[model samples]
Target: MKLTNINKTFGNKKVLKNINLDFPTGKTTVLVGPSGSGKSTLLRTLNLLVTPECGQYEFEKQKLDFAKKISNKEKIFLRQKTGMVFQDYNLFPTKTVLGNIIEGPTQVLKEDKTHAITTAQQLLQKVGLADYATAYPHELSGGQAQRVAIARALAMKPKYILLDEPTSALDPELELSVLKVLLQLAREKQSMAIVTHNMVFAKKIADKIIFVENGEILYDGSPTEFFDPNNPNQRIRNFISSMTLEDL
Candidate 1:
């Protein structure tokens, strides 16, 4: 997927500014920056959850002009191709884990009920939640809920998986559980673009990193260069320092 000259505004504030980016297939692209830097908004744009006022988005050989109004059908089609996992697991309160996982496939995709159930079960096993199939959202721990959220995203068989601060709410122990699942996905070369503050995990998993601040991309390069302690970019160095202090 690719975005060229993208722009978005909310009220008097412009959250995204002429953003140009590319997410290569079968690679992990990590979006990292301080809070309110538009990382999450950019991730949302990948799935068209947050539309830009102007830009061109190309995904799966289909190009969309954001300057024009995007139809509901187009939005649904794009969303189905790009699965999204939020900071908070947005599971249905009344639905079971299995139910949440199968909803998109069975309803949106019109996939067979039995086939969807089988796929959900396999995804549950992959995310280490095989035994929680019958459990509701409120019954699971934060980590478990997040895993369920990941499973739900995978069930759609999307071309790309976009995540926004996926482990922000978890403690170190719980965070590791979720990170392990992500790491496994990275190893499999799943196409993903993630907004995260976890620098360590970003360095470990990212094939490319983009640093955004003040609604602009200040850096876009390999993880090695971006994370290098001796790098000359002052802003990036300072941001990393602050994030380290926050971790302490």
Candidate 2:
């Protein structure tokens, strides 16, 4: 995705100002920033989830003109191409694990139930949740629920997965489990954008690191450069200090 001259604001406050970024295909690009720094906002802009007040979203070489009126059908098509995973696992309480996983494809994609169920089973196995397919969300741990969310997103066969603080709610051990799965997915799938505070995970998994602060792109480089000592960005330094403390 190529974002050109992106600008977003909420009332008088500008969140993303003249932001330009290029997200490589089949690569894990992690957006790292402090809270309320617009990392989530920029990620959401990829699928037009939070439509930029002004910008050109060049997705798959097709530019989505933000100024023009977009039809509902076009929005839905964009949604199909992108899958999102939030910090909180948004599973349906009424649906079993398997039921939650198969819901999207069967309902939105209009896929056959048998095929959806079969695919869901494979995804559940992939996420190491095959045994809990019949369990409710209340019965699963935070890590398990998050993995189920990942499986549900995978069921859509989305080209890119946008993750928002994927393990913020989990315990250390559970967070490790989820991070390991995410690293594996990054290595194997290579088409995801993760917004996270996990500096270690970002260093290990991201093909590119986008560091933002004060609602702007402070640094856009490799994880090596992100961790470089000579870098003069004080905000980056401060953020890394906080991340190190948290990781400990």
Candidate 3:
């Protein structure tokens, strides 16, 4: 998928400016920056949760002109190809873990109930939550809930998974658990784009690192180059220093 010359605004404030990016298949792209830098908004655009006011989005050979109104069918089509995991788990309070995972497949995709259940079970096991099938969101720890959320996204069989601060709400120990599951996904070559502040985890998982600030991308390149201690970009150097100190 690719975005070309995309721009977005809320009220009078521009949130994303002239953005051009590409998310390669079976690779992980990590977006990092300080608060209010538009990383989350950029991630949302991938799932069509937030639409750009200008430019085009190309997915699977289909191109959408953002300047024109997008039909509901087009939005649905785009969304079906992408799964989004937010900072909060956003699970249904009344549904069990298994129910939550199968809802999309059974309802939206109209998959057979039995098959959806089978797939949900396998996904739960993949995320290390096989034993918690009957657990409710309220009954799980932060890490457990996030894992369930990931499983739910996977059950939809999306082409790409987009995560926004997946571990931001957890304590360090719980955060580590969630990060491990994400790392495992990266190893399996799942196509993913993540918005996060965790520099260490970003360094570990990112195939490409993009630094956005003030609604514009300042850097986009390989992780090795982006994370190099001697990186010449002063802005990146300062941002990394601040993030590292914040983590400490």
Candidate whose lDDT is highest: 3
lDDT of 1 by residue, 94-199 (tens): 9999999999999999999999999999999999999999999999999999999999999999889999999999999999999999999999989999999998
**What ranking of all candidate models by lDDT puts the best one first?**
3, 1, 2
Identify the superior model by lDDT, candidate 1 or candidate 3: 3
**lDDT per residue, candidate 2, 1-248, as tens digits?**
78998899989889998899998888999999988999999998887789887778877746677777767877887789889999999999999999999999999999999999999999888888889989999999999999999999999999899898999999999999889888888879659999998888888999999988768898998888888766687678778888898435
Model 3 worst lDDT window (10 residues): 239-248
Candidate 3: regions farther than 4 A off: 246-248
Candidate of highest TM-score:
3
lDDT of each: 0.94, 0.89, 0.95
Error of 2 at 76 (Å): 1.0
- Whichever of 1 and 2 has more TM-score, that candidate is 1
Per-residue lDDT for 236 in model 3? 94
- What TM-score goes with each of the models? 0.97, 0.95, 0.98
lDDT computed for candidate 3: 0.95
